[model samples]
Target: MILYIAKRLSAGIVLAVLVTFLTFLLLSTSFQDVVRTILGPSATPETVRGMMAAKGWDRPVVVQYLDWLSHAVRGDFGVSVYTSLPVGPSVLQHLAVTLSIIIPALVLTGIIATLLGVWAASRGGAADRFAQGISLVGYLVPGLLLAIGLVVIFAVQLKWLPATGFTPLTEDPSAWLRSITIPVIVLMIGGIANMAAQVRGRMIDELRQDYVRTLRTRGISTRAIVFKHALRNAGSPALTVFSLEFIQMFGAALIIENVFALPGYGSYAFNASLQGDIPVILGITAFGVLLVVVVNLLTDLVNGWLNPKARVR
Candidate 1:
């Protein structure tokens, strides 16, 4: 297991570097001038040129990338071109807010999906059909549209919750929860459906395996046979889906955050993109690369643990 984890960690580092380099390359190649964008249309050309020179943007692309990489390695994600604040601190602050919304949604989605999937898979009639229908509806709905509908019904029509803005959890826990509830639910809807489908499929497949049949023939209780044997065996594929879904949730949260006006990394990234704040953009891109690398490493570890074969040479 140690060797497996070490190898995965090493691979994750390499992949992260590649992702960062590619993101930098693409952004640098774009036609827009980063300095001009940050300065806005009203700024004189001389001011833009001076700002670019001050930020070392006048240097060769390779030199600029190397400087950025060096700072990134030391956890200095760079200063935001627009805010003139360190990108790392800004990103970290918003990331905490985003996670506050994402973590609960992830937990709820996983639990609900797993239970619904297992229940639907275990039963073989109308209940199963109903679960399938629910999953279909969830899959069909766009996340932004779902978020809009939720805001309209729960915030506007019902007036049960605040439509937008985040309160510090420490300041007022209830307000924080109320503000984030709709976004969390919107985020989880599609995730639950997708995970439920994956879990149900994996469960059905696992049940058909010879080992599952052997366990059943040995007079094991139905509950133990399904939960202990079947579910454990199905976990390998489910973990794969879970990891992918979790990573996808961050990307999806961008649009959802925009729709709900939540101040998260996604909203910051969106604004940075619109403003062409290269430093902020690069910081966000690097953060995303790091996140993907970490998630992939975690998934590999979980996969190896669940399937001993994965840990073998």
Candidate 2:
């Protein structure tokens, strides 16, 4: 098991490096004059040329990438050309803002969806139908639309939560919740719907197996049979999708953060892409690659732990 984990982690690291390379390649291919963008409309041609030379932006793409990568290895991601701040600290603050919402959305969505799915699957009638409806709605609706609708309902009309902006947790935890609640809900919808549907289907299938019948025949309680035995088997299959929800949450966060006016990594990335801020963009991409790789590695470990059969491989 330890060797399997070690191999997966090593592979994840390699994949992260590949992802960074691809992201850098794509960004470098853009036509935008990043130096001009930084200096703005008033900058003279000589200034732009000198700036590019000074920053080594005129260098070959591979050379520039290696320069940036070498500095990144030393914990210097370069000063943001636009923000005039160290990319590392800027990225961390933005990343923390993102995580504040994404982590809760992932955990809450998983727990709530799993419980509801178990209930719906066990009941297997109207409950099942309701779960299906949630899946359809979540799957069909775009996250932006969902976020807009939620903002309108909860913020504009109901006035239950703040409509936009964010506050740091250290300053005011309550204010932070008030701000993040809506975005988290927007993120939760897809997660809950997808996870619930997966759980429902897996449990239903598990319940139908002969072993489940035999367990029931041996006079086990319905709860014990469904939850203890069938649930374990059912849950193993769902971990793959559960792991996928991490990525899903990140994607959803991109839309939700913008709509909600949160200055998170998603919003930063969005603005950076528009401005051709390669340093910020590359920083975020590198972090995202590492995050995704880590999530997958953790998922593999969890799935293996849950299913003994998976551990042998």
Candidate 3:
């Protein structure tokens, strides 16, 4: 187990480095364009050259990447090109706001989807139809549309929750919950649409296996057989789906945050892109790469724990 985890971690580290370096190389090639955008086309050639030299854009791409990587490794991702704020701290602060909504939504999605899927797979009639119906509706409806409707009914009509803006969890717990609830629900619906069907399909296959029949003949309770044996066996695939759902949730949170007017990582990244803020963009890319690597590593570890064969594979 230890060796397996170590191997996965090493692979993740290598992947992160490769991804960041490639991103840096691609961005570096566009340095002149970025400078032109920042300084405006009216600037003289000398002024542009001076700015490039000041930012070390004239340096070798490899050297520039090394310098950035060295600082990034120390959690000093330089400063934002537009704001002059430290990129690392700013990115992390916004990331915290994004996660505040994403994490809770993920947890709720997992629990509810798993139960709904397992029950649908076991009952195999109206329960199955109902689960499929929910998934279909979730998929067919646009998330933005759903968010707007929710805001109208819950925030505008009833005034049960705030329509826009976010409150920090540290400031007021109740307000934080109210601010995040609508966004969370939007994410949950999308996540469950993907995961519940995956779980139900996997569970159905597991319950039909020969081992399940033997367990039944051995007088195991249906609940025990389903929950303990079948669910455990089905977990490896379900976990894969769950991990993928997490990545999708991260992306969806960006759009959802905009709809809700939340100040978050998505908004930060969006603004940086519009302004051609390379340092902030690079910082966000590095952080996003590392985050993806970490999530995949954790997912692999969980998979190995659930299916011993996965460790060897």
Root-mean-square deviation per candidate? 2.1, 2.2, 1.2
lDDT score at residue 293, model 3, on the 0-100 scale: 82
Flag the better candidate by TM-score, 1 or 3.
Answer: 3
lDDT of 1 at 28: 76
Give model 3's TM-score versus the native structure: 0.97
Q: Which TM-score value belongs to model 2?
A: 0.91
TM-scores, all models, native as reference = 0.93, 0.91, 0.97
Model 1, global lDDT: 0.84
| Predicted structure with the largest lDDT when compared to the true one | 3
Tell me the lDDT of model 2 at 56.
Answer: 76
Error of 3 at 24 (Å): 1.3
| lDDT of candidate model 2 versus the reference | 0.85
In model 3, which regions exceed 4 Å deviation? Answer: none
Which candidate do you rate higher for lDDT, 2 or 3? 3
- Clash pairs of candidate 2? none
Which residue pairs show backbone clashes in model 3?
A: none
Per-residue alpha-carbon lDDT of model 3 for 121-200, expressed as tens digits?
Answer: 99999999999999999899999999999999999999999999999999999999999999999999978988899889
**lDDT by residue for model 2 (22-54), tens:** 887787666347877778889899998798788
